[model samples]
Target: MNSIGRAPNDQTADGGLLGLSQRLPPSNAAAEQALLGALLANNKAYERVAEFLIPEHFIDPIHGRIFQAIVRRIEAGQLADAITLRGEFEHSGLLDEVGGTAYLAQLLTAMVGIINAGEYGRAIHDAWIRRQLIDVGETVVNNAFGRDPELDGTKQIEAAEETLFKLATEKGQDGGFVTFERALTDAISVAEKAFHRTGAVSGLTTGLRDLDKKTGGLHPSDLLILAGRPAMGKTALATKIAFGAARSLLVQGRETGTMPRGSVAFFSLEMSAEQLATRLLSEESRVSGERIRRGEIGQKEFDRFVQVSRELQALPLHIDDTPAISLSAMRTRCRRLARTKGLSLVVVDYLQLMRPAVGTKPDNRVLEISMITQGLKAIAKELDVPVLALSQLSRQVESREDKRPQLSDLRESGSIEQDADAVMFVYRDEYYLQQRMPKDTMFDSADKFHVAMEAWQHKMELAHNKAELLLEKQRHGPTGKIDLFFEGEFTRFADLDTVHGV
Candidate 1:
């Protein structure tokens, strides 16, 4: 393995200076032989390790072939004893390559019993994992030594992280079918939690009353799309949800003493971390972010901002404001946060700005968006956290008479609708109506202008401080519009006053 990507030295032909034995990667040859023997001795023993062990897990190539033959025969509804495999190998003219029929008998001698097959298989797999780790280390070293000039220092680090994440999560056999009884147990557990919890929410509560009642809650392993046209307050709503979830997590932790606020990862592609922080502060303090930025706020408002900022200093919300962050890098960062701090939710501020995994480039924008959404869903499932990704609606929404975004308005990508567990649109009728306000200069008469102005004012009054969250496509629940209170000045969203009417 160490000699893999480079030319062999002069001593390589004669077993190398390091010697063939020393150069070999970590492997348990006896364990491999024992596992194969157990499989050949009792075909039922294969089930003990079938979930994790494969043919390549064997140290010896001959053993791999024998294991493969056994698997094929067993899967074909035929007995896979040593004699049957030998006959199959003989007919295939590959008996000699596997040390003829003698090796089969030797493997039987190597086996102590079929009862230990699972243990032996695990040993072999552990050795293979170690070998893979060594290979990854070598690649990292080789790349660090300038093996790939195109990859800069940071890109190399990201690439290494990507490789390690894949290895850690997807390598070997970590997933398989679950028994029906066990699955039922898990389902019952979820139901029990829902019964005990407020509003029957078995998942993370988003802290929005109507939204929680409508959708239950932000569920784990769910990829939710929060999309809208420009000026629709998508970012504001996403931030609100993140803040709510973080607060809920913190309160729960304090009550149970189990955690310190479930961590939230906000990947802000368009805005810097400070900018996002300011937006949150503006929402909390009821001071306009623009006013704060322009130094237009009074001393009282500024003091309120400072106090709110200090109070929010302990929220487990982390922001990664790297623009055009690739999916691999995002996954790596999220994994790091999950490992160190414990992640509960992820928010990507607009997915269109995100790039796919490094080294992958789609030929068209649509495909790229598809890849990004799929990656987001994958991350949601991998991390067992809800991912709230903001997206841009297509320009076609502007041409519509109602101006309320539908599922088709999700930009150019159909995959966003397809991949998302829930697709929500942030639509503010006030935003569109403000654009249609009649100007006196465009009117021919004062009476006409007054009529237009009055009509516009009536519409504005109705839509003022109101935002509709259109839950268009919910895989597990109903779809409808939920009105929320939106303050454009502070860019904040909250539950509407249902008792007083929205």
Candidate 2:
């Protein structure tokens, strides 16, 4: 038998299976050399890969240093050839380390063609990615072997995910400066879209008419904070917006006869996916969520509920109900969704329920919240999608006579307010007015009690079914209150009309 056909236990002259284990990590030395040669031959080739290919992507240290030196000279508008680079290295007393001028000249011969620079650069970058993945795998294995005692199984998984995410995004193509002319062209395109679309909305529709008019719809790359106290319908309003975005995507897809380019992602940290679906069903079917849960619906209502659910199933909306989800996990999931389904919007039910990236130990609650908010904003910018994160108001909003929420009322106000592009509060006067009903026992006379009760009833009638959306901080536009119709039974929100019940 040949030595190549030896058994697993066999230690032949070639070292058998052990030799395979000792293989070098992924790398492309020739590709690196070709890319460097292309750049040294013609500096214009640098522009082709400058956005994504960094010097660190090279396999050999000498190649990396040469690329870096070339980059410096080219960026400074100077010639970067074998002679220029050698002078640079000699001046820095590193010519011997970089194989001297002879090596620089040899790189010139290594070039296949300058036109293939982009391809060669990409190959080097791909090798670098593979190398990074191998390193990540090694770290994960080491951690699993109890290298990090503080990291439990779940935390180790989170750490691994975070590391991979960092690797994927650190040199991603999502960032770069846009020329003013290009930016202006994009702005004009948005304006043109608004001019042709109904309601003049240049962004994704929130399904609320007044809100759409005020904010020009839920814009991409914006971090909008929707804040309110308990029982104020923060989740309901956020769900409404998410559902609205999904419905819009569906309509566009139907019009075009192809899948829409994007979908909505709702991260319900406080509620289960089923519960959020129930609320959406209730809003659409005009049936109460509580009644649906209690099985109090009649045959007709059940039929309607099922029909609405079927229709909703066609919409491009996704829900994640992972309680206390870490920021990195949410980012990882969003990236997956964006890659697979094309993400348009992200809604975090409430930021307070979210934890920062695993392995981070914040010193205080404020710092923790700051990290969470900053991470959320980063996700929005990274994915180029809107992030509508729900927030809780501080108890201080209750101490005042007016229960309307202010920017200061935001829990962890400093970070939440500062990080958000816009801040809005959902306020329903009926909730507070109903609690202050006058009692006859507190009055000295029957007439006095009757008068107080009448005034209270009038106020209730005025506030009933009416909600206000206070746009407290809008970095892009004016801040004002938008009137909305709130259905308490179904937990639905719509544009309010004074003459008609909408």
Deviation in Å, model 2, residue 75 alpha carbon? 5.9
Q: Clashes in candidate 1: how many?
A: 0
- Pairs that collide in candidate 1 are none
Residue 155 in candidate 1, Cα distance off native in Å: 4.9
Alpha-carbon local distance difference test for all models: 0.88, 0.89
Instruction: TM-score each candidate.
Output: 0.75, 0.81
Q: Which tens-of-lDDT digit does each residue in 269-312 have in candidate 2?
A: 99999999989999999999999999998999999999998998
Tell me, by lDDT, which candidate is best. Answer: 2
lDDT of 2: 0.89
